[model samples]
Target: MSHKGCCYDNAVSESFFSSLKRELLIDTSQHSAQQAKTAIFEYIEIFYNKQRRHSTINYCIPELFDSSFS
Candidate 1:
C-alpha cells in the first residue's frame, strides 16, 4: 500500500488506464457491461500479458519475466 493522496503510489495503474484509453477506447465510448468486461479481459490477458513488452522489466513480456522466478 501507499500513502494516501500520493499519485506516485498509483503511477503504474494510472499508466495502464492511459494506455487502455489510447489503445483500446479512443474511438468507442459505449458498450454493454459484459462486452466491456470481455474486452478488458482479452486486452490484459492476450495482448498486455502475453505480447506487450514492458520497459520496467527490461523490455520483457510479463510471462517471461514471471517464469524466471520459478
Candidate 2:
C-alpha cells in the first residue's frame, strides 16, 4: 500500500491495466462473467507471463525473468 495521494504508488498497476486493456481485452468480446475471468486468467498466465516479451526486462518473457530470480 502507498500513502494517500501518492500517484507513483499505482504506476505499475496502471501500466499493467493499460496493457491489458490495449492487448487482450480490446480485441476480446466476453458475453459472460466466466468468459471474462477465463480470458483474463489465460492472458496473464499464458500470454503475459510466458509468451509476451517485456521491454523493461530487456525483452525477456516475464516467466523467464522470474525463474532467474528464483
| Best of the candidates, TM-score | 2
The TM-score that candidate 2 achieves is 0.77
Q: Give the runs in model 2 whose Cα sits over 4 Å from its true position.
A: 1-6, 63-70
lDDT of each: 0.86, 0.91
Candidate 1 residues 1-70, lDDT tens each? 8789787988999899888888877766656988888888888889988889999999998888999999
Indicate the worst ten consecutive residues by lDDT in candidate 1. Answer: 22-31
Candidate 1, position 2, lDDT: 75
Residue 43 in model 2: shift from native, Å? 0.2
State the lDDT of candidate 2 residue by residue for 27-47, as single tens digits.
999999999999999999989
Which residues of candidate 1, in runs, are more than 4 Å off? 1-6, 27-30, 66-70
Judged by lDDT against the true structure, how good is candidate 1? Answer: 0.86
